[model samples]
Target: MKKLVFVFAFFLCLAISAQDNYYTMYSFVVEPQNEATVYKLVEDYYSKNKPEGIYVRLFENHFKAEDMKATHSIVFLGTQEAVGNMYAGGGNVNFDLFITKLNQYIKDGAGSAMGKHIALNGDTSTRYPFQVYLLLDVADPDKYDAEHQKFHSKHNPPGMLVNMGNVIAGQGTGHYNRWAILGYKDMKSALGGPNQLLSGPALAARQKAWDAYRASNGGVEVVGSGMRVLLGAW
Candidate 1:
């Protein structure tokens, strides 16, 4: 418990920000044949046992790594404390039964990441179909936040969300503990996001802006990047 609080405080990007936006993401593998059944099991369970104040979504990974066996991930959103408490005990017996039922379809636990939402900006009414996740090694949070905010303030994307958060647990802890996500209206927008920005009308200016976004913040390292597709949400 002591370590948990400390990690949250350190990783909860921008400590001044609210803690109500913490998120927990878990990944699992499903056989191609059992994919639909797994989703149906989750949908039916969540539909019946509505956990108050929690919002859940299922994401199908557009896998980049060849060996990454995880096919889908589930994300839970709510206040940090509430989410922590909820997952800490599986919420209740019904949820436990739900998990047990769902586990039969999943091959294994792929991975997971739970942490504070350092910053979140954009529309929430619709969970975009495509999400790009950047695994980063943020050397300086203060500097990174400065340039991140400055760049976005000048040119925020339409119908897009830019989110930066810390990874309190899961893969690459202490190495790449941060992630920046770009949510797009669809796969087309996401695929063309960078090319469209840098290749169109204002190529020079856009290139300069993009360069600055990368150079600043002590040259933040992007360890990896991958996209995710929406499966089910409720």
Candidate 2:
């Protein structure tokens, strides 16, 4: 059977320039049994010490009823340099030195321990199971926009492309090693098929559309790689 070509869809900012903005998304997979404890700890951290480099947006995607524990928590960033700072304990702030910072936040009555929570960090090159996409260009951001509008547009997932002046970000690596988390709002949904397998003339059209969009816009540039944190809503 011929496979469908499904283009992954998401949006991001420009490269790692002094003025460049980067968005980071984080997925923390916590132990299911420690749901309340985990949420409390995470909430406490955000309240006292706001994450630097990127703005934090948190959510727990529950598939079955709300009874299920949070699968992961997500955060977005506005700059790559800012993120580097956060990972390194920005300013004189030293996360490594204050190892108990995270521990102290968790509600004490909760029996669960903080160490159980899974984290992907600088020392740990291991990446959490996630999908990533680089924002390229938009052909006609004004065109067919209303057709794509939805309820709760604020949380509306990132659009295919927007105005030319808008920024564009992509992974630094040539190969897309990140697993793509397909969603209802993605290009795969719009095209009504898989875009990954597209080839020959079809691929050419895809490239052309992106080129035209970039040209019409202010052109595209790098932001960050797939390994960096990135966030998207659907």
On the 0 to 100 scale, the lDDT of residue 177 in model 1 is 63
lDDT of 2 by residue, 18-47 (tens): 544444443334455755665665566555
TM-score of each model, in listed order: 0.82, 0.34
In model 1, the clashing pairs are: none
Q: How far is candidate 2 from the true structure (C-alpha RMSD, Å)?
A: 15.9
Reference-based lDDT, each prediction: 0.72, 0.35
Candidate 1 lDDT tens digits, 44-137: 9888765677888988888556666678888888885566556554446776677767877787777667776767777767677888998888
Give residue 69's lDDT in candidate 1 (0 to 100).
62
lDDT of 1 at 195: 40
Candidate 1 clash figure, as a count: 0
Q: Model 2 Cα displacement at 40 (Å)?
A: 1.4
